[model samples]
Target: MQPADGINLHSPPPKLKFEKLSAYKKRKLSHSTVNDTSPPTYQISSRAEESDNSSVVEPDKNLMAEYVDFVKVKPTKKEEVLRILNKKDVTSPKFFQLDSITREDMSHWGLNPGIIAQLRDNIKKFEKHLTPQ
Candidate 1:
């Protein structure tokens, strides 16, 4: 029935002594006041307007050309493969033969595995559609 330690049970815990902050310290701790009336001024560069017109316009044209080249290059082989697959009167056997070669070529095409798998699945569906019952 007795407490384990010899310490008194009913006595209040010792009060914590915190030092009072001085006025300077209190001001440092408080949120800083921002001026709301005047709009903030930005330091505009002297070359900003000239750079804006030159840099912006040039990059966009270069980007468009690069983008066009990118578009032309990336999908050209895939488009070729698709066009071959969709050719008139292509038999199932021929399709499977082409698919095997194309699958090998696709590993070199820099395609993701999931996309290659999907393409394989699409080829299978196309072959099924082409085959007479």
Candidate 2:
């Protein structure tokens, strides 16, 4: 009796196999069992033919510069601050209080206005932590 799908599953399926390119070509070229009218013919051509006259296009430097100019570089302000802060000899709130690093300097280094107060507080805390009780 057939299943509900009404499909016949009586015989085992054919086993899958593969042959080398040379063997396959020989088998196809000679007829053994395949009863097809004509065997498929493949045309292989080389792409390095000198008859090809297509020239490689060079990119415009000016056009590339226009696009590249829009890329924003990462600011080294945080690194500068960390370098100063990590200095063993320069661990004082007075250093921050000195006019060496001004609001203009912060702005030039791409630091926000709010970072000034935060830096001051961090410096104070760091100073307190470093000093004895």
Candidate 3:
């Protein structure tokens, strides 16, 4: 009979079985998988003949520098504070102080003002928990 939800409940649940792979099958699977550590090979055609060649493309230095600059200026006070608080040995008061200092540093490090405001709000929330009982 169908339930109130109008769904069939008479069917049995599916059964799951786990099996071990044979050594030969495992070796075959490993051979089929591509190794990511090595650079990929490509077919390059010169004149009328095509040859398989592996080439490593190096990233432009200017592009890498731009990425590094972006990362350096990103606001990370919240993560830093949480990391400090997660340590088991640190006391609540010390954690709060460290969080405040880190927050100030992040503000001065060219982080967006909105992010600093959010970090300040987070600090207030954590302050409530860290206060003496």
Candidate 4:
């Protein structure tokens, strides 16, 4: 509703414009090094060098492709693989998922330190044999 003076009380006040401050001269050199010929010790160059080969090296695509199937397999699928490994009879050669199998699982499966060491040695030997010459 309008006031007795005919002024709209609901209307907001008009916006005010402000003038910006004058720009100042930027300092090219520090007060201490104004006449010095030596380069500034603390100053870092913004320019990138063409010879700067420093970068994050990505994994080789072909090498990564070799293990892509292993990476894609789910945790449940990996456990199923462990279960299949567990089901193998004592007479058959057994394989363990070293990454997935914990110390508790090894102890539960009746593996001692000597057997674990043998298993690691065997794995290394197998890796050496399977790797390309």
Poorest 10 consecutive residues by lDDT, candidate 2: 64-73
Using lDDT, rank the candidates from best to worst.
Answer: 2, 3, 1, 4
Per lDDT, the best of the predicted structures is 2
lDDT of 4 by residue, 1-133 (tens): 3444433545543443444544432244454467787655542243211212223334333322223222343444444434433453221111232334554565566555444444433433443544699
TM-score of each prediction: 0.22, 0.28, 0.20, 0.26
Query: Which lDDT tens digits does candidate 1 get at residues 22-42?
Result: 998777545232434444334
Worst 10 residues of 4 by lDDT: 47-56
Q: Clashing pairs in model 4?
A: none
RMSD to the hidden true structure, all candidates: 25.5, 28.6, 21.6, 21.8
Once fitted onto the true fold, the runs of candidate 3 whose alpha carbons sit more than 4 angstroms away are 1-107, 131-133
Compared with the true structure, model 1 gives a TM-score of 0.22
For model 2, how does the per-residue alpha-carbon lDDT over 15-123 read when each residue is reduced to its tens digit? 4244556877688666633666654544324321221222332344342222212222124444444443444233333344445556666555554556545554354
> 1 or 2, which is superior by lDDT?
2
Residue pairs in candidate 3 whose N, alpha carbon or C atoms collide under 3 angstroms: none
- The CA lDDT of each predicted structure is 0.41, 0.43, 0.41, 0.39
Considering every candidate listed, which one attains the maximal TM-score?
2
- Candidate with the larger lDDT of 2 and 3: 2
**TM-score preference between candidates 1 and 3, better one:** 1
